[model samples]
Target: MPLFVSMTAGGPPDQVTRRAAHPVARKGINDSPSKVIPTNNFYGNLMLGNQNQGVWTHPYSLRWVKGTGNSSSWGFGVSHIERSQFAYGPGNPNKYFIAPLGITSIILSAQELSNSTALTTDSLEAFSVNANLAVSAQSGPLVTFPLVQGMGFFTGVYLGATALIQTDVFFRTLSGPWTLGTSLKYKVLLEDGRTWLFYVHSSQGYVNPQFILRSNTTIQGPSGFRGSIQVAKLPEGQSNAESWYDWAAGVYPVTGATFGTFNNGSASYTLSWQKGGDTGKTLIMWALPHHIQSFNGGVGAAATDVQLYTTTKGQATLVASDQWVMVEKLVTDMGFTPWTPQNRSVTTLPEKAIVAINSVASSELNQDFAPQTNLDSMYFSGKGLAKFAAILIAVNDLARNPGLAAAGLSKLKTAFNNFVQNTQKSPLVYDQIFKGVISTAGYSDPGADFGNTYYNDHHFHYGYFVYTAAVIAHLDPSWLNQGTNLQWVQTLVQDFASPVADERFPFSRAFDWFHGHSWAKGLFESADGKDQESTSEDAFASYALKLWGRVIGDAALEARGDLMLAIQARTFQNYFLMDSSNKIQPASFIENKVTGILFENKVDHATYFSADIECIQGIHMIPIMPPSTLIRSKAFVTEEWNKYFSNGRVDSIPGGWRGILYANLAIINPKASYDFFAQPNFDPSWLDGGASRTWYLAYAAALGGCT
Candidate 1:
C-alpha cells in the first residue's frame, strides 16, 4: 500500500522521521530482480476500477522532436537534445513521487493583504531584482511548510504561521530560448501574531545549474520587526548540517568585490560565494530578526524536484521550450526506455500470461457449467460451444510438456466425447438446428428469426464450435479422419462454413454477398431486411472457416474464406466505420465515431444491449485474421484510445472491452500494452468472464516482442 501523506495537517506526527526512501513491495508480477523496475505503472489498471493507479499517476510525459525551421538551433550543445517544461500532475492517481524544486522561501500571512504585489521567477542568474519585471498577484493553490523547531524560519521567525506564499506560471507549449521564473508577494502572520509584508523570489534558467531564492519583509514601523535572513539547504543524506542558517545582523549594501555579511549583533555570520566548494553553491547577507529558511527535501537541488513545499500558498509558473519533440528528449534524459518483458521468447510468452491462463482454466475446469434451463436450445448450444472451445484450446496449448500434456489431453478427450454426444446426429442430436426447440426460456426465441433466431445470433453460436473443431483437427488429424463417431464435428463445421448451395445449409447461408458481410438474422424477417448485428462475430465466423480450411487442406474453402475477408474489410469500413453523416447509417448512429448494428436499411449505432461502443469495435478486431495494416490504416485504434482512454477514463471500463482495447493497443503501442498487462494487480475481472485471459495476454505479449 502507498503511504498517504495528509497535506491538511501541519506535518507528519513528531515521531515520524523523514526517511530517504520508502520500503518496496514484493517483486512485481512477472518481474525479475535483474530487470530495472519501472517506477511508473503506465496506467495499465485504468480499466479495472474507477480509482486511478498504475501508470495513471504519472503527471508528465515526454516525446522526441527533431528541430526544424528557425528552431533548428535548439538542443545544440546540451546533449544536442531539448525537452519540454515538465507538466503538472493529472490528479487522480492520489500518489506523488516527490521531486523537489530548488530553494523554497515563504512569508507567513497573519492577515489578508491582497493588494500587495507577488512576483515569482525561475532562473539561474545572480540575485539582482529589476523593478520593471513585476506581474499581478493571483490567489490559487496554497504552498505551505511545517513549523519544526530549531529550523531557522521556525525558531527565528517564531511567528506561528502555518502558511506561506508561493506563485508559479505554466506554459503548455514551449519553444527554444526560454526563461524559468516565479516570484510572489503575500502577507504572513508571525508566531507573535504580527502581520508582515514579505517578498519571495525563485528563479532558474534552462542552461543554469543553480537557482536562487530570496525572502525579506518590507513592513517597517517603530513596532515593526527588523529584517532577518536565513538560508536552508535540503541536505541530500541523513546529514542536516546545512539544514538552516540565520543572518545575525540587519540588511545593508555590499561595498567590496568580495562576499560579506552585515550584522546588528556583536557576532558576525559571514556570507561568501565562489566556484570551488559547497559555500560557492550559495551565499547570504542580512540583518538580525529577518529569518531565512531553506532545507533540501533530500531529493534534489532543483526547484521542480521538491515535494515538501505543497503547503506553501502561491502561484507557480513553469517556463520552458514547449516543443513537442522536447518530451522525447526529456524521456531520454530521465533514462526512460520502452519496457519489454525480459521473459519474452519465440516459443513462449511472459510468465504472467502463462499463469493467468492456467489459473483461469483450473477454476473453470473445477466448476460445473451453469444450467441452461431458462434458455432455449439455441442459446445453450451456442454459448456452451464457445466456452467449451476456449477450454479445449487452453488444454492443447498447455499440452507441450509431457506431464501437463497427459492431463490436458485427457480433459480434451473427455470434452470431445461430451461434445459429440450433444452435437452429433447419431445417439444424441437434440441441440442440432433441426431438433432445437423453441421453448419459453429467458430472451431466447429460436423461431423468431428465419428458422432459428436465438435472438438473431445463430452464426455467432455456430462459429465457436467450428473454430474449436479446427483446433482439435490440427492437434490430431486421425481423431478427425477415422476416430469413432467424430465425423460429426466436420458435419457441424459444414453447417456453418460450407460453400453456398442447397441440399445442406445454404452456401455460406449466413453471409450476404450483396452486403459484403455476414448477417446473423438466421430466420428473422424484418422491415430493415436481413441484418447481422454483430459484425465482430461475423468476421470471426469467416476467420474460423479460413483456419478450418487450412487444417483440412481444402484450398477452395480457404480461398472462399479469403474472399469473405476481403469483402468484409472493404464493406465494413465503407458502411460500419464512419465519422460524417452518411445515408448508409442513420444520423443517430454516429456517436463516438463508430458504426453499430447495421441493417439493409436501418442502423442503430449500438449493439443488441447497447454496451460500450469500444466493445463492439474490439469484437470487429478480434478475428485477428485481417492484415494488421487493415486495422491500422483506418486509424480506428488511435481514435478509439484518444476518445475514451487517453486521459485515464478507461478506469470506468470493465470486462472484455478492456482486453480488446489493450490487446489492440499492443499492435501499435506495445510498450503501453505491456505496461498494463504487466501490472501486479492486473485483474481478470477486466476480462469479459467468457474471454481467455491467458490467450489475450499471450497474444499481446507476442505482438510486443515477448518470447
Candidate 2:
C-alpha cells in the first residue's frame, strides 16, 4: 500500500523519518555475509535474525532462496532487486531503483556413497536457472508467489528445496504478544517422496530467530501426504497470539520437544521443506506480506489538545495531583494520547499510569525535613533541594491530605532561602565545573571527588538542582522574576543550557550532538577519553531542562530538551542497554550491565560506586521523571530485573538502593514495586538521605500503575 497518495508542493519535508539506506545486493550466493539496514538511526543493529533488517517500501526487495538434497546435493541463491512499483518520497521522487541486483545462486553435487545411487545432477546449471527472474521473479520480500517449475525443486534422488524472503520491516519486539497476518499458499508434490517439512522463523530485534517448522510433516515416516494451510506453535514458540508470552513458547518441531523461549526478532523469515530416500517430490510455498504484531497495552482517559495552563503562574493553589492535571494537558499538547490502565505497559506510558503509581509521598507531606550531612558535596546538597521539592509536590497532590499545604509552602520557602544563603557563603568555586571539594575520611576530598573519579556525573548532581527549581517555580511562578534570591536558580539554567557561548559557562556544556547523548567526562584524565557512565543521569539532565524550560517559558529550550531526549532515547537503547550479546562487555556483563562509562573506544560496565549487582542495576535507574516522559522500555526493565534481582535477592540488598530497585521496577512491574515500597519498614532509611522518602513513595505511587 502507498503510504502517501500525493505529496504537497515541495513534497513531504525531509524531517526526521525512520533512517534507512537503499538496499545492497548480495555479493555471492552462499558465503557472503548478510547485509542489513538499520531499523532506526538510534536503535540500529536490532539483530533480527535476517541478514537485512528494517522497514522496506515499494520498488525494492531483498530475497534469499535455497535447495538442499538429502544425498549430498544442495543449491542456494541471494539477491537484491528494484521492483516495478510506484514509490516516491520528498525531494527524491521515483529514486527507488537499485542496479545489477546483487544476486548469486549455487548448487553442489558430491559423489554418491555406496548405498546412494549415483545422482545425475547438473547443480551449477540448476542454480543459474534458479537465479534468473524467469524461474522465481520477485518484486520485493513481501509478495504472493504462484508455484512454478524450479520455483522450488526436489529433483535427483533425495532432494528438497527452501526459500527465505527478508524485508526492511519491523515488529514490536519489546514485551510482545505480536500477531503476524499472512495469506500463505503451499503444496507438497510428493507421491513417493521422503519426509519433508516447511519452516518459518523471525528475530526479536536483539537476537536471531529460531528456524521453526510451519508444516505438520513429521519425520516419523511420511503417510498419505495432503498439504493444507496450518497455524502451529512449531514447538518452543506459539503461532496463536494468546499464548505468545508463555515460558514454553519455543519448541523444536523435529522432536516435539521444548527448548528456551523464542527469539522474537522481526527482521526476517524463511520457509523450507525437504524430501529424502527415493522420493523425488518437490515442495512449493508462497506468501504475501500481511500485518505483523505491534506492542500492545491498556488505554487511558481522553485528553485535551492544548497547554495545561494559559500561564505557568497561579499554580501555588494547585497541589501535586492538580499539577498532574496540567501535566496531562501538556502531555496531550505534545501529541501523545493518555494511556488507559489496560494498556499502560507499553513504552508509551499514559497519565493514568503516573496517577496509579503508589508511593509514600502523602506521608512525607507534613514531615519536617533537613539536608543531607554531606552538604559540601553538590550531589548531596542538590538532593537536599530535591527533597524539599518532592515534599512540596507531595503536599499538593490532589489525592493527598491538603491541610499541610500552607505549612509545606512555608517550609519550602525557608529551605530555599537557607540553601541559597549557604551556597553564596561557601568558599566553593564554580568555574567550568562546580568545584567544592573538602578532604574527608573515605576520600581526601568528597566535593572534588565528582571531578576526579566519577568525572561524568555532573549531570546527575546538577539535575537535582534543576528538578528542584522547576518544581518550586511551578508551584510559585513569581519565583522566577520576583526576587533576587530566586535569580540564582534561573541563572543555573543559563549556565548549563544557554545556546549562546558564555565565558562563565559553555553552551549546552555536557551534551554531545554527534553521539545524541551527553558526555559525563570532566576533570578526570584518562586514556579512555570522555563517556557518560550513568545513562539515567544523562536522561535526568534533559528531563530537568524540559521541566525548567516549561517553568521559565523558554519554548526553544524546552524543544531542545525534547529533541535531546528523542536522540538520547535511541542512543541509550543502541549502546548503553545491551540487547544481543556483543563484544562491548563480557558475557557476564551482557544484559546484566547498563553501560557504566562508555568511552569512544572503550566500554566499561563499572559505576563509580561498588560494582555489586545492585549498583550495576541502579546505574540506569532514574526514580523521578515528569509523567510525560517515557524514560525506559519494559524490555530493558525485564532483563535488568531477571538478570540481577530475580528470586529473593532484592531482600538482602540494604539501604537506599532497595528503594531505587523498587523505583526501577515501576517501569514494567509497577504493582510489585509498589508492594515493596508499601511495606511498613519501607522507611526514610531506605531512601538516599538526599531524597524525601515521602516523595519517593508518592512518585512510585504515581508510576506504580495501580490506584
Candidate 3:
C-alpha cells in the first residue's frame, strides 16, 4: 500500500540532498579562527572572543581565564562544586537551584604563557577542544592542552616549554616525587584542605622533571620541558582513589567521539576516546549518573565513594576505563496510531465516536490554514502546518471521511509550499558563520522568536515542519518528488540532527549524545553551560525525526530517533520526571515532581517566562503525541498530577496549560481526561494553537475512554 516501499528497504534515502547554500543572502560569518572544525559545539567557548566562558565537563568546569580570574595568570582554571556549595531558592522543597562559579582549585599554565601570550583552538570535535598557547600572535604555540569532557586529568602536551602551576588556594604542603611507571607523581595539600595529585611524563625516556616551588601560590616546571603534565583532585581520605588515578596517569584522551547502532528493539552507542600517550594503558574517565546507570560490561571497576556532584546532573562516578557502552531498549513499536495507548495498524471505532471525530475534523478543516501576520517565525508557521496535518490525518484515518481529508490536504499543501518557495515574511538564510539554516528575523533583532537567528532551539522550532512534511508525504508520496519539498525538510533535519560531520552543517547540533538530551541554548555564552527547558519538545523533535525517517526510508535516521527516544525516556525518568523512589536528585528537591529548567550549573523549578506552577509543570506536557506516553510514563504522570494538579487544582488554571495537563493525564487516567474534553461546555480557548479537539477526543477514546 506504500508508494515508496523500495526506499524503505535499507540505509538512508539515496536522493536526500545536503545543500551548502540557500536562496537567501549568506550572512558573512568569517570570524571563526579555526576553519577546519565546526563552530557550534560543546567547546564553542574556545572560539568566542577571549574564550573565557567555562565549558562544563560534568563534575568539573574548565575555563581559559587568560589571566583575569583568581589564578592571576594566563591559563586554564578547573573548578568543582560540592553539594554544600549549591544555592537554593525559597521554600521547604526549593523552587530553583544553582551552583556557584569562580571557585578555582588549580590553574594549569606555563612560564612561557602569560598576559602577553595568545591562544587559539583547533581539532574541535564533539567532546574535545585543543587549545594552543603561543608566545605571541605571530609565533607558533609552545604547548597544547587537549581539554576533554569526563577526563580524570587536566593534561598539557608540551613542545619545549616550561610549566607554571599556580592556585589561588595557596599550597600548604608538598609530598613525594614517587615514580609510577614512567610518571613522576606528587601530592599537594592546598589551603582549602583538598588533596591534589600531579603527574609528569617525558617522551624522551623516564626522567624526573622536577617542579621547583616558586612560592606559596606558584610551582615552576623544568625549562624547555617536552612531555605531558597531568593534574587531578582526589578525595580527602580515599587512599585507594590515588592509586586508581596513578594507574591511568601516563595516558590521556586527545579526542573523543561517539558511534551509535540500533537493531530490532535494542540500541547501543559507544563513546570512545583516542589516547595520545601509552596507547596500551587504560584511561581514567568520569562517568555521569546517566552513564553509570546504563554502562555495559566494557568499562572497568568504578570508585563509587570517590565521586563529585555535577552542577546539574547529580553525582559523577570515576571509571578507570576508556570506552563506555550504553545500551537502551528502543520504542520500536510506536508509530502513526490513531488514538490508542497501544500501537495498532488498524482499529474500528464505535459509530458514535467516529461521527463526533468527523464533525470536529470538519470544523477544524474549514478554519484558516496559515497565519496571515507574523509569518517570519518557523516555529509558529510550522505549528500551524502540523495542526492542520493532524486534522487531515484524523479525518482520513480515524473518522474515515475521505472528502474532508482531501479538502484539508489541499489546504495543507498550499500552506507548506510557502516555506518551500522561501516566500515567508522572514525567509531562512544559511549562516556561513555557524553553518546552519537560520531565520533572518534574528539578524535585525537578536532575541526575536527565541533567538532562532542566533542558533537557539532549532530542533524545537523546525521539528513541527518536519513532522508536517512527513504527514503530507505519507498521505501523498508523490509530493516527495515535488520542487524542493523533500530537500527543504531534509535541510531542516540536517541542521538539527545531522548524522555526520560535513562541510555545511555540524553533526548532531541540538542533540547531545553525552547528556542523553538535546540542548536548547546555542551560540550564546552562559556561565552554567548549555541548558534545555522543555523535555517534551526535546522528545517531540526526536519523534518528528523518527516519523520523517520512516516516510523517507532512512533506516539510520529512524534508528537514531528510536535510540534517542529510548535514551531520553531513561534519562527523563532518572533526572527530570521524578517519582517518590528516585535517588538521583536531592531528597528535598525530588518532591517537586518535575525539574522545570535544567541548566548545566542549576536545576530551576520554574520557566523563564513565568514562575506559575501550571506553566512550569505544563511546559513538559504540551502536544501530547504518541511518544508522550513513552517518555511521560503512567507512574510519573500519576505522581506529577497527584502532587501538583490533583484535588480540583487543575480546574483553576484557565489556559491552554490546563488542556496540556489533562491530555498528559490520559497516560494514567484516560477516563477522566476524556470526560473533561468531552464535556458539552468545553471551551475551545483551553486548547493550544497547535492542538485540535478532534485528535484529543480520538486519542482519549482509543485509550479506552469511550467505554
lDDT of 2 by residue, 399-463 (tens): 34344555666666666655444432232223222211111211344235364222235566667
Query: Model 1, poorest ten-residue lDDT window?
Result: 323-332
Candidate 1: list runs displaced more than 4 Å.
1-406, 423-455, 482-486, 579-591, 611-634, 705-707
| Quality of model 1 by C-alpha lDDT | 0.35
Q: Write the per-residue lDDT of candidate 1 for residues 1-707, one digit (tens) a residue.
A: 11111111111121222222212222111223222211111111111121111110001111111121121211000000001211222222211111222111222222222323232211111111001001123432121111111111211121221222221111122112122122223233332222222322222211222212222322211112212222222312323222222111111111111111112211111112221112212222211111111111221122221111111101111111100010000000100011222322224445655665566556555544433111234434444445444454544453123344345445555545554544321122212222122112322323422234232454565566566566656666665655342345445444444442223232334564323466665332243333555566676676666666666766445445544554455556556654443233223333344555554323444566546656656655553322332423336566666765777766667776776677667656766765676576888666654454544444455555244
TM-score for each predicted model, relative to the true structure:
0.44, 0.48, 0.93
Of the candidates numbered 1 and 2, which has the greater lDDT value?
Answer: 2
Report the Cα lDDT for residue 24, model 1: 23
| Regions of model 3 farther than 4 Å from truth | 1-40, 204-206, 300-306, 338-348, 372-374
lDDT of every predicted structure (CA atoms): 0.35, 0.38, 0.77
Cα lDDT of model 3 by residue, 620-661, tens digit? 886688778788877778888888899999999887788888
TM-score of 2: 0.48
User: Considering TM-score, where higher is better, how would the candidates rank from best to worst?
Assistant: 3, 2, 1
Candidate 2 Cα outliers beyond 4 Å, as residue runs? 1-368, 398-402, 422-449, 452-456, 580-589, 627-629, 704-707
Model 1 TM: 0.44
Q: Clash totals for all models, in order?
A: 101, 47, 0
